[model samples]
Target: MRKMILPPPPLFSALQQPAQHLLPYKTRKKGGGGRESARSSRRPQYCRDPAVHNALYTGDLQKIKSIFKDETTANLIIDSLAEELVWSAELGLWVLAPQKTHTSPLRITVSRGYRDCVKHLLLQGADVDAIVGGKAALHDSCANHRAECTRLLLNYSANPNILSEEGLAPLHLCTTQESLPCAQMLLEYGALVNQNTRDRRASPLHVAAKHGLDDHVKLYLCYGANIGHRNREGETALNSACASADKPEEAGRYYRVVKRLLESGADAQIAGRKNHTPLHNACSNCHIRIVELLLQHGADVNVSNCAGYTPVDCALHAVEDYLEGEPEKLIATLLNHGAAPINPKMLKFCVLSPRTMEVILNTYDRILSCDSWVEFVPSEVWQEHHVFYDSALCLLNQPRALQHLARCAIRKQLGIRCHQGIAQLELPSSLQEYLSLSLEGYLK
Candidate 1:
């Protein structure tokens, strides 16, 4: 992974020491036999250049006015004021918090890990957690891996939890390819264990886990992250680990994080959307081992997603299930692990077997009649979701929700589609048939 190289300070100047000598620059000599050749020409220095300094710190017109009241001011005026403002701000922050600054100082001599500069600013007066362009100075120190600077920020009472303008804290910046030492420093400074970004709900755990950073995960967990906390999608840290995203390295990182969560006693059975649990997600992705581990850890086999599909049912039917292993082992594992009985009705529903609609509509009757099967699941789990009611009701003349009811002369009752996939699901056999017929008008 490449490290993030931050740009030069906000007040960047194009002033290079101009060539003192009127000649072309010499390129470094290729591997040569000469030990010492000649002294290099020194570049000319441009001092107290005001226009350049104004453009560097903030190209904003207001900022320019605040620093140099007159645009026509001499170079010395601009230079001196700009320097003073930078130092004053630095001092204000340092006396307040030695280690923290809202923004990096604009100095002729840029401070990189300058321990004394940080301390000087703090003792003289500076707010450690001051905001600059909506950023914390600690962010800059960390981004550059200036460990000494970071130490000062911590000493001065910088709030590690304060996210910067870009939604990054010292901890987030430390995760970049640069700033390992800065990350360690923030870790030492009492940064939150699972810091979250302001723009999104991803915790530091999510980022570290996504990057496959086992070390980072260890660091975050040690600091404090609720491994089971659900993000917007209601997915816990373990659920994120099992997602098959386009990035393999990221996926691997999540997998490692999931392993850690499990070891730490994360509850995989804490169910989520469409009723899917971590075990179901594990099975869906063909992570058979993860599925098994989840089951071993008390994952519910019969807990169905909103689609009313059980863990084994999802494994047996999703197009990708074959990637992990064959079906027989999956069935055996689920059964031995206390799966609901696999009756004819369940067989059709679980794998979408070739049961006619006639058989499916009557399947509920068969299950409730069987005392052995009723003990395993709610009668509704195997039945198409329905509501039956009232001696005077009739399926043909009722409200929309009661249309699914069967109207027999023996009695009048209302039944409705509750949570069943029976309404929208298309069996494999109907897929080609629909495409073949829908595209043609002959069926009409």
Candidate 2:
């Protein structure tokens, strides 16, 4: 497959030759084993001549005025990373590397939040659309959260949708709280609210949800952003929110994003690349609150992904400790929502989670056998929670208690409406709790 190459912005034409001259001229070696020998494996260093780089990076307005006296000097591309050390696999050694990145003075000033220098550069004829390192001045300013610089550049007619080298639009680069204002400015200036990245084809909403930026998500939705837009992987913003969260502490924020997306008519049942629904992702990631919310919003409890793994299968595959609270609550919720029973052999996966095992056991009236159930439990976990497992093992081949039998019958009768049905039942609190499959961490 051929990769599409984006042509550099027309603004780059002004700096191509002069930028090369800005590089510190390397003097030739005089002796055989002298300069050339030393240079063969040395890094090319960028010299920050006070007259040029000093004024730009430090926001020295007077110095910049004196240095960039003409239009040509104002557009001279500076070398930010002239050289670096990188591994050379063919040579089997680390080598000094020269990278080609013609950074514009406008990019440097705006990226560093040097508003005065940036304004002066723009006034002195700096091309606001200049492509530096594959990103325009607007992208650099927005990425660094420089609101003032961003506003100035936008006022100068910077292209809001210019694709960076990585194919991310300027709006896609706004991934932090500080970048919110920049995003707003871009939108106010007519940035495409539903524009997607060239790589992931992910809209700004997908990026916002994946990063748990509730404010950004809200802002995008308010601007008529597509709630059901899927990325390259076919994941909607809701799917991205559930699947991309990596920290347990961030669950609350992602929850809000999911709720907002759902409230705005985002499809909770939208399947992504692997045929994994939002519920499947929520279960796999052990997000109990999200799992319940998704289910309550009509997420399919028994739908399987492309891998033939149902939401229950995903729950079984979750890390016991990662569920934040009781892992059994989720299993119970699935069972109440009409999820299929666990295969006896798969009970081995729950041995480490005593409460979860109890919940699954209570849903069944009786087990036909106990040999696999007993052998599947690891010796150490079994020893650690002997009280729970021992009691559970005892009931393996025996008939369940009459009370448990009644609970199973009621649950089976209620079926899919079991969750809401039990809530309205005029039963005692203990009975209501029993019907809801509340965890006792032990089999009765």
Candidate 3:
């Protein structure tokens, strides 16, 4: 067996003689404590000491204690840089743009989960609340999910509500499922549950909802987190849950988040800056179950956003993006609740979605024109589902089947009560299924 030989530390050779340049300085007085405020426009001049850096990063407790026996060594702040070349618009050239970070041993230990070394550094008088490159020891501990390190820091009187240089509290830093324990500790230690970010003004609940952290959201609500608190965008926890799911399959997790929020008194119809309700957001994301839940909670199916696009329109727009997720069903659900029909001009948009076209055509009694709709679908997609598209195009100048006409008449009479009225009409199950717009890939 061969042992792996790692490269030597960047500062190993420089530490032979006293590296006076790496000693701690008052970053606050110099206005250079954080990476963003100080390093935004210009790079900072700095150096690193390998002995302490190695000990902290590697969780070497004995090594940390040996050097930190000298109090000054434990509190030293080191500067590190990430080298990269980026285009500088002002310079009009690609420049060697480096990101400089000034961090302390306590922050590094907590971030890397070096629990014992963190305790040793604290015993040596390390500032538990020390800010390094925009984050404090507590912020790093929570962000990195270092539970024990977080407890030690909190026990040392670290401020759980201390805002990072980016203006995020430690509670907001707990974005992952593993960070739930850290968040619990922060909340128990008096962290504000509804603290909003400075830029987005999103609360901790918003963060948890967006990231799909079920336990984190539950814990916050248990601690009396305000469910109705809206962000700068007027998005409550429910809105965030519906809008933040990036994948169709991932929508289920966010759906659960929205369900919990609603159970806790989150309003479903509180629109955001764009007046987009939770239903609009859910339909746009192709979340059938979420859309159903919002509707059941009395969400207005016909409510339009600032852009004048209703939830039905949102569902159509989501069709191509979520082809595998059955977006057509979302449109059917909206229509059953008396949502306005799809725009005739937009019929072309659903060319790739034949089943969606079937649902819409079944809703109308008059014959639909499809002469121009054929041109909307690409040749390849049309060729792939020719049977369905052909039958769809045939209905352009012809009246729909008698069954569909009956469905249209019954639905129109029931109006908004179409969904519930048909359920208890005492009709056969097959007749009930027909009125609910069950998919057939064709109108007849």
Q: How many residue pairs clash in each candidate at the backbone level?
A: 24, 0, 0
Ranking by TM-score: 3, 2, 1
Whole-model Cα lDDT of every candidate shown, in order: 0.49, 0.79, 0.79
lDDT tens per residue, model 1, 250-270: 445556667777898788787
Reference-based TM-score of each model: 0.44, 0.86, 0.88
Write candidate 3's Cα lDDT for 1-444 as tens digits: 112233332543333233334332322222322322231221222336566667777888888778777445666666665545666778777666545557878888889998888888877766666666778889989989999999998887777898888999999999999999999999999999989899899999999999988899999999988999989888888888988875866777787888898888889899986999988888888888888999989999998899998998888888888888887788888998889767777777677888887787777786557665668889998888788877766777788778778888889899999889999899999889889998776555
Considering TM-score, which of the candidate structures 1 and 3 is the better prediction for this target?
A: 3
Which candidate has the highest TM-score of all? 3
Model 2 residue pairs with clashes: none
Worst 10 residues of 2 by lDDT: 33-42
